[model samples]
Target: MKDNIIDARGRACPEPVLLTKKGVEASPNGVKVLVDNVTARENIKRFAKNSGYEVKVEENGEGILLTLSR
Candidate 1:
């Protein structure tokens, strides 16, 4: 696991979103969040966008990779 990477693959709903919030807070430059489900990906994407960040999404094996940056 990387310091700027949040692995929320096995988690669900609010947990993934919450982890992403924290990750973004801690990483001033950017944050990379990993989630295995669509819900988490969408939720995090919306949250990041609402919070004034740019989200870059991509497929990561069996999961999704969301990269948030200001």
Candidate 2:
């Protein structure tokens, strides 16, 4: 089930959000955004929500996963 994961770990601010935007635009189905920090998680979550997508957060040894779906 893991697919199109945008790894934004160690990235700051707009970078994560920009990557997410590009991912979303590229994939109409949805995407999984992976972030290491809470700030990145929150920013990506907000960006996903504003783009009219549902956000599901998951924590794992790898990092924080922000799953975005239509």
Candidate 3:
């Protein structure tokens, strides 16, 4: 399966979540979302979990990487 990446870093709130939702809907395999803030990271994780996708998070110096897989 191919992985789709959504770069949401430097963006605020719902924008990241919205981009992630779009990416998830467009990609059958999975989506990787990059967010620089805690709020965006948590929001995306919550959104993905509630949408029935398996969520994983990785912390980095720049930001967090959220992996949403079905």
Candidate 4:
């Protein structure tokens, strides 16, 4: 299982979710998404969850970290 990281900070709306989807499609094992705002964080989490992946979120000074695993 490989871990893929998608940095989506400062990006708006669907961009973050899109990157997350791409990362997940590329690496089904795990995906770490870095987002700057609450909206992006929630959106990515929801997308991952709805796609059958387990979501874990962590708060950081720069932004939020979403760890998605299958």
Candidate 5:
């Protein structure tokens, strides 16, 4: 299935991860989370892993893109 994208740049700590988690949970397929910080990227990855979703990450310029799939 296709995925959705969420731009979470400039957001702090749990906000980025929490928002990403919510997006993934609400999606019918999966979500792609975009963040500008390493912490946000790691946190989102951990959240996906903990929630049992497949995750992939890519670094684009100064941002991180996280793909979450079931």
Candidate 6:
């Protein structure tokens, strides 16, 4: 089954990424994280990559969608 989704909009620098990290830790399969800032997107991408999860990031309107699968 697909894991959880984390919507981290309106949250400033690092919070989104931090929350995403927590979501990743909580998931046995993986998770999808949505963030509206470039920095947050990059941070999640870096974390996912470093953690060895397969990641896909897409542009959704003004926000970014990150799908992580382990």
Question: What is the Cα-based TM-score of model 2?
Answer: 0.93
Candidate 2 wrong stretches, greater than 4 Å:
none
Of 3 and 5, which scores higher on lDDT? 3
**Models sorted by TM-score, best on top:** 2, 4, 3, 1, 5, 6
> Which of candidates 2 and 6 reaches a greater TM-score?
2
Off by over 4 Å in 6: none
RMSD for each of the candidates = 2.3, 1.4, 1.1, 1.1, 1.4, 1.5
lDDT of residue 4 for candidate 2: 95
Candidate achieving the largest lDDT: 2
Over 7-27, each residue of candidate 5 has an lDDT whose tens digit, in order, gives 999999989987887897789
What's model 6's lDDT at 63? 79
TM-score, per-candidate, Cα-based: 0.90, 0.93, 0.91, 0.92, 0.88, 0.86
Better of 3 and 5 by TM-score: 3
- For candidate 4, the 10 contiguous residues with the lowest summed lDDT are 1-10
Best by TM-score: 2
Per-residue lDDT over 1-70 for candidate 2, one digit per residue giving the tens place of the 0 to 100 score: 3399989998989899999999988996699998999999888888888889999999999999999999
Q: Tens digit of lDDT per residue, candidate 6, span 1-70?
A: 3758899877987898789788977885789988888888888889888988888988878578899998
Candidate 2, overall lDDT?
0.90
What's model 5's overall lDDT? 0.86
Model 5 misplacement above 4 A: none
**Model 2: which residue pairs collide?**
none
Q: What is the C-alpha lDDT of each candidate?
A: 0.88, 0.90, 0.88, 0.89, 0.86, 0.85
Candidate 1, 1-70: lDDT as tens digits? 2448889999969999999888877886679998999999999999999999899999958689998988
Q: Over 4 Å off in model 3, which ranges? A: none
